[model samples]
Target chain A: MAAAWHVRGLVLALLLAAVEGRAEPPEEESPWFVPDHAALQLAGSIGLLSAGPGWGFLRDGVDAELLLGWAPPAVAGEDFLTVTLKGQWHPFRPAWRGWTLRPLTVGLLLSYTFGDAYFVGLPDRYPDGYYWFKTALRPALLLGAGAGRPVPALGLRLQGYAELVATDYRLLHFLQSPATAGTGLFSLALGVRVRF
Target chain B: MDGPLRFAVLGDIQLFLDDGADAVEDLRRRDVDFVVQLGDLTEYGSAQEYAWVAELFDRLPVPSFAVLGNHDVLGTGADIYRRTFGPPFLSFQHAGSRFVLFDSNSREYAFPGNVPDLEALGEALAPEPGVDHRFTFSHVPPWNGDFDAALTGPLEQLQAERGVSASFHAHLHQFESEVRRGVPYFVADSLEHRNYLVVAVDGPVVRVERVFY
Candidate 1:
């Protein structure tokens, strides 16, 4: 029922967990409340580019992140800003020569755009059910994979990942107009993660 | 450019992208002087939807124009519409016929009452030489609830006085045609209905037909 800009978000934790997520408690026992990684992503539906903090859980199998996204008028055809909350679950982590890879990743995210024109709640303009979806908030589905390698000297891990994002509006249209929206249903996003 | 002025008018495309695409393909085969989409080009009026619809319009070889729709005004959609297709209101004379397109979706702005802009319509439809027929295009028919209730009568009266051959609209999502105050009003169905309208004017006579894609 709704479709907007092709923005994408979050895949920060999979690679962070792949690096030191084997639960080596004695090596670096930090507070669980502290974030395990930070990520900067390009073209994930959240924006043309976004950066955020992420937390890894379930022995690095699960990830939660908060991202701040932006799109400049030059690239997006106009200026746009968004905040996104994303969660992901990685199923497989294989290592080769000290580089860990997550082959399969699946996730969900909800994004909120910042502007006076957008509304979380319906204005007094129409009936109770004028619009079923909120213009300010967007929910989407995510599928992607990533790989990470530890840099011992720098005490940080470098990771790279990519995702195919299907926002709620796009998914809805895909369900109805398969022939028209089939190829455009999902937008691609690439991102990098730095494990602390 | 020849004997008769023939143009195609498409109603609300909305979410039916494939239908709209099919219509475009169907239109490419026909001989039309130009094409006018009555608006609601996008479902939510999002940037990507605008891009998709714009891409569709670009596929047409004939010159095409779109009026503003309520959905097209959602969020920053109006701004996007401007970026994609010039301004909301446009008036020009082509082949001895006056074609006027403007914004009539008053409820989108909570019905500030100035929508439909009769003053502008009066000026655009002013008596001019070589103009034997006049046509108007917009979203939301006057009878629809989305249109400003206060301005409907005034709008109809103005069209009647201006001798507008026919007023075209899309928003009801169904084909409807009726005469009010001696002027004919045509409401085009959404693209999902798979039907469009064709208007042809020759000399002082004008004819409209419902076309199926």
Candidate 2:
């Protein structure tokens, strides 16, 4: 439990340091690897909590992020460590009363879990094509919306968002047994993103 | 004659909770002494799914047993299976017949070659004072590639030599039955097919009937 808190604190500190460092210049003028934003998310199948830095492209309309996620054994019945790479496109950003509302966002993510229990490749036991899917890697589709406003005092743009995530396991089960798993196809995730 | 011993055999219920529930409802109306499930009980091997399936099994009117399937070993599923339904290998006597349920998902264990522990099975197959016949159950058939190749012939020969009446398995999601050597093998269809096998053991004779609901 203490280790989980420490990890969370470390992630927050890193995010804060990145935001403070971004005050120097415009992102385009800065190095390409410099992150423009950081995000902390809760519960979207990646883990119970995930945090990471993000880079924006195409005039801030598209974003790509790499997140490290963890699910504590206390909550998940087992500890789960996952690394996720996500790409999102926000097509519409409407500003109203100093608030920017991105009402539509579509994204995709590929997450790989670290554990001996899961396997990316089939073991030597069976012949080829025994099982169709890999247990270690998961792919998911995301639909979300965000609302944000610039906070000049903090030198950041604070945004709050909610996403509907549909993972491959859920999708396949929904297709195979719609009556039992239809409503559970999509899980909700809530997060906050700080753009520098 | 003491009459025939009646039992039920059902197949994989992976991700099909409603179908499994329906089959249980149908089984409740039958006069079977016990039920044997052919594994793949859950899709993702999640705790919730295991609990759901266990609850469904609890609704049955008689004793029940479950074999561990490849899907049931995913993630923390193997632990959940052990906790929910005891060990994967089990042997018991009901009426005059001795029934053995063992793990045949050799590939799931990365081909440890001890999955269908022949030693334990050999011990379980030994003749007892009052037992009239023997039956074996597993998730995967020995003929399937998922089963360990080296143990297939030996296991079949052992069963035949011991005068085993029949063997049952499920994983293909389809029904198939054949005789290998001198022993009969039956594979039940998945619950989604709305069918199951009803086996009646009469002294030395075994009758298997495929019933569709």
Candidate 3:
């Protein structure tokens, strides 16, 4: 529990720093390594909470993020550490009353968990082709929409989004046993994205 | 003579939790001595799913045991299985018969071939003075590709030498019964099939009947 709280505090601090950084005079030709945005997410199979730095491209319609996620033993029954690389595309963005609404967003992510318990390859105990799936790596698809408004005074944009996530395991089970496992095909994740 | 010692056997319950629940309810009414479930208890081996299955098992009136399956070993699932169901390899005597449950999902371990732990099986299958019959339970049958190919023959031979009355397995999601190397092997249908097996033991006589609920 303490660990989860610590992560929460860190996320808050990062967000505050990102917002504060936006108020400074823009750097002349900022380095490519500098982050353009940050995100904080709740649930969706990564963990109880996840936060990350993100970059935008393609006219601010395509976004990529690197996230660090943790779930404490108290909430998840075991402590889990996950790092995810996510890519998203928003094809349509409309402006309404000073707000930009992205009605459609499609994304994909691959998350790798850090722990001995999760394996990318079969342990020496088993021969090759024993099990088809890798436990440590998980791939998922996301569909969602978002709405953001520019805060001119702060030189930032605050966006709120909701996503429906379909993980590989969930998709496989849903296809195999639609009658029983269909309802669990998608898990919901809510998040806030801040752009500077 | 308590008539015949009767026990129930169930197969994979993966993604069919509701059906599994119905089967458990049916088993409760059958008055069996105990129940053995072939694994694949959950679709993804998540802790939440383990808790759900454990809760369902808790509702059974008779003692029950679960075998470890391939799906149950995914991502920390092996640890959760150990915590939720105790050791994957276990042995106990009940009603003059010896029951040995072991991990046999060799493919999940990438086929290093020690999954069934033949050495441990040898110890468990060792003859006991008062034991009238011996039965073995595991998730994968020796005939399946998921079972270790190199150990299949040796495993069958060991069971035959040990005089195992019947070897029970689940993983194919179907039912099959055949004799391999002079030992009988039975594969129970998955819970989604709405069927289970009942084995009655009388001294040296054993009878297996498939029950559909």
Per DockQ, the best of the predicted structures is: 1
Off by over 4 Å in 3: A1-34, A56-63, A72-79, A87-107, A114-136, A143-155, A160-162, A178-183, B1-3, B15-22, B25-29, B48-52, B55-61, B110-114, B143-158, B191-194
Model 1 chain B — which ten-residue stretch has the worst lDDT? B42-51
**Please, what are the lDDT tens digits per residue for candidate 2 over residues B1-213?**
456899999999987777888888899999899999999998877665687688788999799899998899887788888888999999999888899999999888777878789999999999889998999999999998789989999899989988889999999999999999899999999998999999998877889999888
Q: Which pairs clash in model 3?
A: A125-B112, A126-B109, A126-B110, A126-B111, A126-B112, A127-B110, A127-B111, A127-B112
Q: What does the lDDT read for residue A45 in candidate 1?
A: 78
Deviating ranges (above 4 Å) for candidate 2: A1-29, A58-60, A74-78, A95-99, A149-153, B1-5, B15-21, B42-64, B161-163, B201-205
lDDT of 2: 0.86
- Candidate 1 residue spans exceeding 4 A from truth: A1-31
TM-score of 1: 0.91
| lDDT of candidates 1 onward, in order | 0.86, 0.86, 0.85
Candidate 2: count the clashes. Answer: 0
For model 1 chain A, give the 10-residue run with minimal summed lDDT.
Answer: A1-10
Question: How displaced is residue A132 in candidate 2, in Å?
Answer: 2.3
lDDT of 3 by residue, B41-158 (tens): 9876877568767877888999999999888988778878988899999999988899999999887766876978999999999988989899999999999978888999989999
